[model samples]
Target: MLKFAKYFFIVFLITAILPLVLMFAWNNSQMEKFHNAMAKSAMSTGLMRLEYSVKTNLKVQEGDILRKLYYILPNDKNLSHIKNILNDYNTEVIQKPIKTPVSFYERKNFDLYCVTLVPFDNSTKGLKISKPVSLDLLRPTGPYTIELRFNKDDAAYEFKNVAFDPMAFGPPKKIFLLLSRVAKPHYKENSRREIALKGEDNSNAAYLTIELAFGPFRGMIDSIFTSLIILLVGILSSFVIGLIIKRVFVTPVMALSKAADQVKKGNLNFKLDASSKIEIIKNLYENFNDMILNLQTKEKLRESFISNLTHDLRTPLVSQSQSLEFISQKFKEIGLTNEYELAESLAKNNEHLLKMVNLILDSYSFDPEKLKLSIEKADLYEIIEDCKEQLKPLLAEKNIEFVNNIYKGGTLIEADLFQIKRVFINLLSNAIDNTSGENKYIKAAARFEDEEVLITIEDNGNGIAKEDLKFIFDRYYSGKSLERKLGSGFGLSVCQKLIDMHNGQITVESEINKYTKFIITLPLSQHPGKGTKEQP
Candidate 1:
């Protein structure tokens, strides 16, 4: 039972589980790689958005600086209104500055509301601005100069200070301070002050780091678990399916195997009880029944052969015994004077025994391998002429007319000359014996086709029955003989065997009471160097 289970398990693994497992592993791995790549791409796209926002903000700020400069130098009322409009624009459109708490500080002893405009410069070029100088005093009817200072970098910018309501420009000091602190740690001590004014520098890098750590990493974990669960479900389903298939299919096969074993042990009486739903098993069962029927047929043939052998042997023996008894009684009466008559009787019985023994030997020689053929290149027409001449005496005794149509140019074929001559002789003899009329005739013809030679011997004699034609070449098959005497029934079988040896063929076409024609076809050469075998 363990052996049977092991066999089924191996089959299951090969046919079902192994393929499914490999596919699951391969698909799961690909899904994992796909999820990881998707998460990484999403994070990269988000970082690109942040960088684009920063660059856009810098462009807006540069435009604002240029507008402010125009308003100071020209002191145009139109320029002042433009600055007011710029201040009303949303902060998101300008830059991504930090949101900070709004705070108000009053400068001590300054009657002029000291509105400090933090000079925003993103350039790294070295330039300096001195303390405040009156621009109107220098140019008369122009803007005043305001001092801008960076305490850490010791850099200052003196820009024209135009008078306006500080309330119009919202307080950006708290927002700037918060942005500066966040931005400072990313730069060197000396560069921090420069970078603080340009708020676009370090904001993009911080957002990219946050997205990678939080968003994509969480997605990777979720994708891994999902793929693993799918793989587990596939494996479990394959196992269940394989188990059910083994029970349905393998069980029937095993039962058949056991039945076969019992049959081999000489138990032909055993019958299989395992009925299966599989088509293959059903076919096997039918074939097993056919095998048993064939075995029974063979046993019957064996018994028949033994019984026939006894009857055949007894007939000849009984005839010889009666001949001996007659010869003894005659010798006692005539006192052995008429010796010649006694000798003739003994010779007749001896000839009968000799013929039986020769028939048995000829049956053995009908084996293809046992017959030694003297194969050579010879004229097939010449061989047919020789056969006609040798059998002329027999034809004359029967007053039968012989017709010869040996083809011109004499067809050449490579064949066993002596064996082919014997084939013709046997066919001609059978024809002579079967012919009945005084006008009995035998027609022998030869023709040559491309690559092959054909020789036919046709007789206007009593033909064979349709049912008897099929078994005519079987050993010892003698159909209704016209003479009512049995010749050894091995002639046609010998012809078939010899033709097969030469890689040629023999066939008989006959209709009852019409005529029988024997057609033999041989190749142009049967050289030992060019041996051939019969096609299956």
Candidate 2:
């Protein structure tokens, strides 16, 4: 989740937030440049007013030079009468030629306050020094400031008693006085400007200096707040996007991963929760569902092929067993009973083989169309007798006694003779496989009851577990594991299908290591309420 959140945040930054920052920077820079141009015009006007105050108003001329400083109020008009203002006794202190011509000072008064300077030329000089200007113009009681210097060499001025000054407040870390030669100096805000002092006249009056300031600091402050808002929004959006990503992308993908694991474990029937609001995941889910269905179809086809192939293999074995039976009888007629025994053993084994083959085929033969039963009237007891005879070798091998108690009267059943015989043989063989110990016996009896034939095959053998009896009729479900390898786990399954086709029901009852009984109820056609035309 954290990984997804991280990636989502990055994507949001690139796709959504980056443009906001770029646009803000570009606009802030452009506005600052435009403000500088406007400030220059305003400063040009201030310079004109100062030049008029010096040249036409004060009107002192030729070689009038002095070097002394004094603070004067703007209302003081005595500046027009003061003589040799620059060439006074202070001028004799260090007589030298004055190269720089223009000068100015910070203007702070009862009704007005402004920025003192921005960027100025080297040829300009500082000839005027004004009182300290308060920067907290929005506050009634504000910090005081003053510029204290008179040099034209560097055109740089130093200030005293800034509001944040440590001497007056707390600690002093550092202060900023100048900016380098990039574009603007010191600052570029609506609250600050650059002042330039220049004129054509010299010594006529106070130096004609121009004072201006850059734009205010509010624009920069607004930009900073905008950036902070964008940062906050970007962070908030990152978390929301992270959750969306987990739902739309991560969740479904993990489900698919678990589905893959199920498939690997051969669970083709494991269903996927493919529902989704995302278009891409919906498509993927549909494709995966199709894939699982295809695999099931393929598996069914493979099972059907093997089952049918087993049926084909059983036909030749049946014929070979009949041939061996005929040969065994001929040998017995010649009093060669020892030679006849081998032929009889092979014939019975062939019968067992046919029963197993049929069981294998029936396991997969769920469709009634695949059965192809040729319904005809046949003696049920006679078929049971024949199936018993076919399994005589296995019975003898286990020393088990087989009792056939099916009635010889009204023993007619409208059933597929071949399939009926297969079922009878399968039941007898299964009993023989399970029968063990001395005096092991299996009994088959049939009786007419309520227009149906009740045929039961009971055995005193290694009986089935009660839990296993219920699943005995399921395809490939064995009553006991002992008979599993020999019987293919499909004897009772095949019997149940054959009985169902005859419109009859088959059931079993058992107790472990005691007795097992299988009851088959087949509808009799020739009996009172039953008829061949109606069904089995």
Candidate 3:
């Protein structure tokens, strides 16, 4: 479980951390775009307000200049005084070297008359023009004698442009100021657009001008602040998500895994809590608990069945054995030869049957903790010969060869004589049941090796399949082929248990259609250790 959790946590971290980092980066990018868009929107609104402010100030300035020009025009005073004042105002206030020029014109028959009070060259202030400038060059359109038109040639004129005469014609009609730019050469290309006045008619018109200035855009959000916000959100989200997964997925799965291990180790009472909110996890826990409960139920039924079965069979088998021996002795005393032999065979068969019943009882009631051993030096060959004698009828019926290959004096093993004899009987009986055909043989062999007695019971017969080999000795594990007529599936399990109690090991080697061999290794002396007790 420790190893599994370690590796699973690594996988979880990879799955969780990588996506969180990617989401953080993507969210940061989106937030930056939104911040820039809001900043631009705010700047656009500010630009509109700035344009309005410039228009209002330009209107007031225009009113003052118009008043000065009007006084000079009607009073017929020398325009030089007002023109000089304009030049001074332009140089000091407007920050330009020349004054705003004004042209005067009056309608005449089919043509127009125009004169400039201040020349474009600015050579002399209020220089009276010798000739009229062309009125058509201004392209005056609509009811306002001075019309505002955008100049494409002057790219810096982001606002509208109005070309008009700055000097007063007469004081009579409606007038308004317009913010606009003048065409190039007269001012720098980057200069702010000029503001000029519009009049309803030529009878009483006065025009004045000023420059409009606007500020640049300034973004509001800080880069570091945006990054901090993203980081905080990412961390909070990761924490919440990680907590949820641990509660919903990881914790429940680990619980189930631990529970499964306990069940495997014969702890049928172990269970897991089944009350999870997640549907799949809840179902999983519920199923695991249900399975453990079923196993516990089955185990109880099995133990009860074994107890009842052994008690029912053992009593009758013991009585029948005693009765059969008495009958055999009576038949011998009456001098009925054939009947006496039949009775003797019946007695032997009855004894074998009684032994089988006892074997079943012992196998069912086996417990490692309650094991008792009568360890003594006994002949292993004598035990094998006895087991063969018990199974001699079955061997003769099948015309099989029974080969005892033990050394002359017989190998001795420090073990319980009865348990060792039972092991040989179970093994030799299994070999006899499986072996057939004319040349079939069951071989019993033993040797002393490495301070242990190695006993082998082999058969030339249909060998065990590879799939069944691993589970061959497990209780109630019946292989596909070795179905004994006597026991259910406890023979090998019993043999293995008996060998384990003697501080010994039993193993099997086999190949399909070749040969099956059972190898039993027992220490020359029963060592007082695990699975062994002092023969008190």
Residue-pair clashes per candidate:
2, 18, 1
Q: What does candidate 2 score on TM?
A: 0.38
Candidate 1: list runs displaced more than 4 Å.
1-357, 407-409, 480-488, 529-536
* Candidate 3 clashing pairs, residues 3+ apart or interchain: 170-204
lDDT of 2 by residue, 117-155 (tens): 111122132222122222232111212222222333333
Could you list the CA RMSD of all candidates, in the order they appear? 21.1, 21.3, 18.6
Report lDDT per candidate: 0.56, 0.58, 0.61
Stretches off by above 4 angstroms in model 2 are 1-292, 304-367, 479-486, 526-536
Residue 52 lDDT (model 3): 52
Instruction: Give candidate 3's whole-model lDDT.
Output: 0.61
Please give, for residues 1-536, the per-residue lDDT of candidate 3 as tens digits: 67766786677667766566666556555654554464454434433444354344434444555565554543443445545755633321222233554434332333333333332224333333313223233322211122222232322222222333332122222211111111001111222233322222334222212222111111112332444466567768777987887777777777888888777545677878777778898888888888888888898898889778878988987888888788888888988889988988887788767766776677768776676777777777777788889889889989999999986566777888877887888888878777888899999888878888888889988888887787778666677655222245678888887888887899999888789999999888877776555566
lDDT of 3 at 367: 72
Evaluated against the true structure, the overall lDDT of model 2 is 0.58
Tens digits of per-residue lDDT for model 1, 323-370: 776776777677785674675567556655654555555554444645
In terms of lDDT, the poorest run of 10 residues in model 1 is 186-195
Q: Residue 279 deviation, candidate 1, in Å?
A: 14
lDDT, model 3, position 450: 86
Q: What count of clashes does model 3 give? A: 1
